[model samples]
Target: MNNHFITLGNLGLCVAASLNAQRLFKDHRAPAAGIFLVVCSAALSVLPATISLDWSSQPAALCADLQWAAEVLSPAMVSFGFLWLSDDHFTAYTLLTGSALLSMLTGWLSRDGLSVMSRCMAMSSLSCSLTVCLFAGNPLGILGSVLLSAPALVGLSGTSPLVSPEAAGGLLKLGLIGAMTVGCWAIRWALEIYVQDLKGWDKSNNILT
Candidate 1:
């Protein structure tokens, strides 16, 4: 089902980020195993709770789950971001997280900070891997996929700097990412509703036929 895709996407994000952060740590000659456990555990345990117990629709559930997960988790990541990617350049990690946080902000409008934080990290890492691979030229392109390497998945700590002409510019970027994430979910929500209605109509038509 769509839930499977959403789960895969989330897991993929975690794995990818773990990989990237691992590589960064290794290159820097830091301990990688311990940090990886905390990141992976935090993601696995916390991410699932975001899905509403009443989740009923497929696409609706997937998008909502993703958005909510980001909303709950992002702020923490933002606060401690400098620790992970190990830079204050926004690195690809922080840059993508801005978009993930944006997604959460759109959904909750400022409630449940932890849920928002989760969503932010999950979506941000996911986006970073996708974006880097799409654009990066050589090894840098693969740089987005560090967590996949077994060595990179464990022992992790890093940092990064914020990138933007100004705070407002960064906010603008985050806002845009948030809008897009929400917009995609909104479209999926509407589409799912339409499909349900069509299914109802088809069943009725079948009975008549």
Candidate 2:
């Protein structure tokens, strides 16, 4: 039971990594290949979990039929992940775009020690931003997303990285993360305030039980 949750979380991370890769680089090839791998791995990992979900019942029936359905549907679900990763570009769009972005901004990283710290903070923000996007409405995910905001605020105040566009783009990424923090809080608040009353609502405590 615990393994299922862990595997599901792994699937989310892989899918999110694939999506973030495409977002960062705009390259379809790496993300497409990654999606294929992720889908295969996800099924190999999650099929067993689905069977375990049946244990919530009196006597779990054999999951042969469900497993077969999962097999048939897994390819399409994997394709959705692929599409989510690609953003629909045919060529190496993400890679090219991300490369261009980094190239256009490389000269501006601060040589100073204080500025280096700022850069580190910005990097942390970027990581948290993606975590927020990956987790969507989850409170823990939203907390990760909130962490991004602090770094963004720090980066904006501490760095002067505008001589080149590449560096500027990096700074912009940090700023985007700050923006996402607000979005994450909004979603979290919405879920807490309005969604809890829904009929099917229950805490995640039972997910692993």
Candidate 3:
């Protein structure tokens, strides 16, 4: 089916983004950031499958439980990563712990269905992540966070002329995943250019000296 292919494509993109993150941040300059991005991307890669499981008829209870857990937990990893990149260790750790606990609570409370409280919690998490990305001064991170969170915000708004309600969710998921993939590659390209510029500057300075 077309939907299945689309899901697989999204999954592949997330996985590729994860690998790119690993390579980009492998340097000592941002090892923690790299780790966080890798973890987040990996989680995202499987998210479609998890979401599918959640929607499937007569899916195993265990799989459904795992889906919700992953949904609530993975985005925090990205937030923590961006916060760490900004050199805000205290806030990062505090928020990481808090989000983890909240995610667990959300999972427990919304076993049968995703409740309003759980949706609010997710929105709160995305808002926090977006704020931190803005504060951190990384354009790519900010853009990625925006793309990543836009779906939740739009869903909450409850209406869109561009997309019918029935098809909106799937389209939003694809858009989010695609945006994340593009953002990762863009960040990687920017970092590469920066490093090259630094090396060139260093060479010029050495020559003058």
| lDDT top scorer | 3
Clashing pairs in 3: none
- Candidate 1 per-residue lDDT, tens place, 1-209, comes to 43444344445445543653455353222213323433453355235546555435664455444433333233223223222322334563455455455554655554334333433454444444334334422232233123221111110110112222353223333343333223223322322333355567789999999
Q: TM-scores of the models, in the given order?
A: 0.25, 0.24, 0.56
Candidate 1, residue 34: lDDT? 26
Please rank every candidate by TM-score, starting with the best: 3, 1, 2
Cα lDDT, all candidates: 0.37, 0.36, 0.52
Where is model 3 more than 4 Å wrong at Cα? 24-71, 111-118, 151-165, 168-170, 183-209
Give the per-residue lDDT digits (tens) of candidate 2, residues 1-209: 44444554545634553454344233333323333433343344445555555453433222322222222222222222232332433323443344334324435544354345434434443343344344443453344334424323334322434334353335443343334334333423433332343323445545545
* Candidate 3 overall lDDT versus native: 0.52
Model 2 regions more than 4 Å off: 1-111, 136-155, 163-209
**Candidate 2 vs candidate 3, lDDT winner:** 3
- Candidate 2 overall Cα lDDT vs. reference? 0.36
Lowest lDDT block of 10, candidate 1: 151-160
